[model samples]
Target: MSDNMFEFAFNPGEEVVIKIKAPDLKNKMGGETLQHLMGAKREMLLALRSLLDDAIARTDAADSPAEKTHIDIE
Candidate 1:
């Protein structure tokens, strides 16, 4: 097994709540691959709420500036 890991932080001033050990990709059986993939998906689902909230906040901030900008196109 390799020492590879994935980490995601969805909010500022908070510790990373999701950490997944990377799947061994060099040579894996079908079941092994599926298991690893499912583990990663589960971790993502656990963080989905925070992730969605962060995404919405960022999109709103970006849209606000775009709305204030005036462009003239000929």
Candidate 2:
């Protein structure tokens, strides 16, 4: 490993393992921050899905087009 990006050489079949540790990230704030952000994103996706399902359900039965499950149309 080298600090200078322009000066590094690697063998053709060499195996390299990298380990990174973040004491700050593992601390209270960083851990909680990531957890909260992930939770919010998951909730947002669920809410969006619910809204889409509701809209689809609300469409007029006659006006609604055929639904495709998996097979290609074209």
Residue-pair clashes per candidate, as listed? 0, 0
Q: Give all TM-scores, in the order shown.
A: 0.28, 0.41
Backbone steric clashes in candidate 2, count: 0
Report the number of the highest-TM-score candidate.
Answer: 2
- Worst lDDT run of 10 residues, candidate 1, spans 1-10
lDDT of 2 by residue, 1-74 (tens): 34321233457799443332323333445667878755765686677689668878787665778887897788
lDDT of 1 by residue, 2-71 (tens): 3555665578887666566755554554677777876776787768778879989999898885447778
TM-score of 1: 0.28
Q: Which runs in model 2 stand beyond 4 Å of their true positions?
A: 1-29, 60-74
- Cα lDDT computed for each candidate against the true fold: 0.69, 0.57
Write out the backbone clash pairs for model 2: none
Clash count for candidate 1 is 0
